[model samples]
Target: MPLTARHPARGLLDATQDDLGCGWAWDQVHNVTPRADLSCTYCQHRMHAKRSVAGLRYFAHDPGGPQCSLGLETMEHRLLKLQLATAIRGAGHQADLEVRGPEGRWRADVLATTGSGRRMAWEAQMSSITADDARRRTATLAADCVVVCWVFVEGHRPWMPYVPAIRVRPPADRADPWRVITGLFRWTGLHWEPVQVLLDDFVAWTLNEQVVPRRFSPPRDYWVGGWTAPQYLAQAARRRL
Candidate 1:
């Protein structure tokens, strides 16, 4: 599957000869030794005449080729955890990474203990809450012990709010709806707000929020919960680069 024809829901880039009807032709086109810059002469001539290349090379080559990057398999929530941990550590706080909890497991991306020795659990959320997980974590973690934060990234402005639990809608249709949802809650000031978000949007939200804050204060307790493995890996890779 070429990038242009790929399904929105699936990241697969089909390069099979059978599907492309070019058998070994594709290999020749893609595998040829590197050239400084390949340009279609015919298309260039037509462009000089101000014409379109709609059907000229439709079968000759795929304009949108395969995406060779093997992206990470982590979710935005997990990336947020990493970011929060990074931020907390930068803030000069005594932080721990990935702590266990009774309900399931609490991996504090960044754990911090206040000067007074008070514990604070911070989570970066970019997805909606399922009724069950929300109830369990809320019950297991003390309100005062936990301080849930969310980073919503959208057009122009982005917001980071420290709150309790974040309300996320079902994952459907949207790619990354977290930014939109978080934008909606900017004025509320409450940590937990019901919002619709997609996976990628949430990742962006977390990254923007964590990078800035972590530079100042590393978190005491950190957890992430809304993206897939690939997403998380990409984020981690970007940070490393």
Candidate 2:
């Protein structure tokens, strides 16, 4: 399931808009006109509008559509990506879904862009991945000068401290907000400590430069650990600069 679909003429249709319609209405797209010609942005498979029991809106591949990697995406992954896009847009940035690098070098679940032209990729990595694999992916983005933030909404986050990432406690209800459990920290005069914050605020502050990534290199002073590299450096001197 994906929240975005490519319209032959309209270009891209965002299913998350709560309004009854986008440039096209929900009634026109959802089960009414199967000929609307909406297709998956990732796989080009035909897609149709779908709503969850809780009223979350997104697109699902039409029946008989070929198997696409995006079709394997879970509801958890879809929701997290949706939330990331919403937060990015709420902060006045452009949030392009399923954005890919040239020649498939990399892909971002939600690619955010600042008015100043800075770019960051927000990835909702719900599946289990080895730390080495995570580092390799992060390094790929780094080589392209593309900043990436890996967000884990479930499972053990063994790679959180190793990369510029964060672990969020999923809300019990879909309408509830996600809470940051780890990977965001503020420095005291002497050491680092976890910072409790909502996911929306974190994204907003980060895009606005209220927070930045910091590596506790030697990390011994913080007693955090080796292999524990990039983490958040929350508001203060950096914001002043």
Candidate 3:
């Protein structure tokens, strides 16, 4: 049998003081002493702080301790979900963080309901997930009229050949909405900025099989302006020069 290794660090529900008793609270994680007041949020084991070279802090269990799935989340995953929830609510939609769907069949990192009755499930995928797993999750959510969108948090290295690109499948309610949407989350010092593009003119650019966008930058703030598929190809080609 192949040996398996446990994940080093994972995301906390909220690093804020509200979760102070959780032991790995943002404030307590920076302290020099190990906290005995709280237990692991997932497993009831005691956790100790592990600081990185960059001074970023996370929690870890003692040797021979059992592993935790919830503790396998990265800090990026936590922050992105929080920010997305806040942004969704700010956009005048009803946003709920870490909400469970009907019968607890599914859980969305950030579930937002638009004023016009559109329910969107935003998933910030920072870890590796199989194609089958992705399809299964999507199918389950779709059954409940929930549109699930996977957002990659790879930060702005779109120039890399292996970066992920997604095809836009219009909502079932729409009529032949042939738009291609592609993008990723970029870390801008303090927060992650979502760079997404939905282009109807992708057919012309798709002809050049080598073209792929590394980042999506709108002309102005928000998803405004006319971003054509050709423009993205042009920008990508120039960077290769």
Estimated TM-score for each candidate: 0.31, 0.84, 0.43
- Candidate with best TM-score: 2
Candidate 3's C-alpha runs over 4 A off are: 1-66, 155-181, 184-241
Q: Which candidate do you rate higher for lDDT, 1 or 2?
A: 2
Candidate 1 deviant stretches above 4 angstroms = 1-78, 102-109, 125-129, 150-241
In the range 1-241, model 1's lDDT, one tens digit per residue, is 0011222232222222223222323333343455112222112111101111321111122244333211111244444444444455445454443444545344332345655564555544344545455445543566446543333223221122222333334334434332224322211232223345543444334333431212112354323323223333345445555
lDDT digits (tens) for residues 138-210 of candidate 3: 7688799986656554343232222233334342443443233444333444443454433223322222222
Which pairs, if any, clash in model 2?
none
Best by lDDT: 2
- How many residue-pair clashes does candidate 3 contain? 1
Q: What's the lDDT for candidate 3?
A: 0.48
Model 1 worst lDDT run, 10 consecutive residues: 42-51
Model 1 gets an lDDT of 0.34
Put down candidate 2 lDDT per residue, 67-155, tens digits, no spaces: 88777889888888988888998999988888778788888888889999988999899778887777888888888888888888756
Model 2 spans with C-alpha error above 4 angstroms: 18-22, 218-241
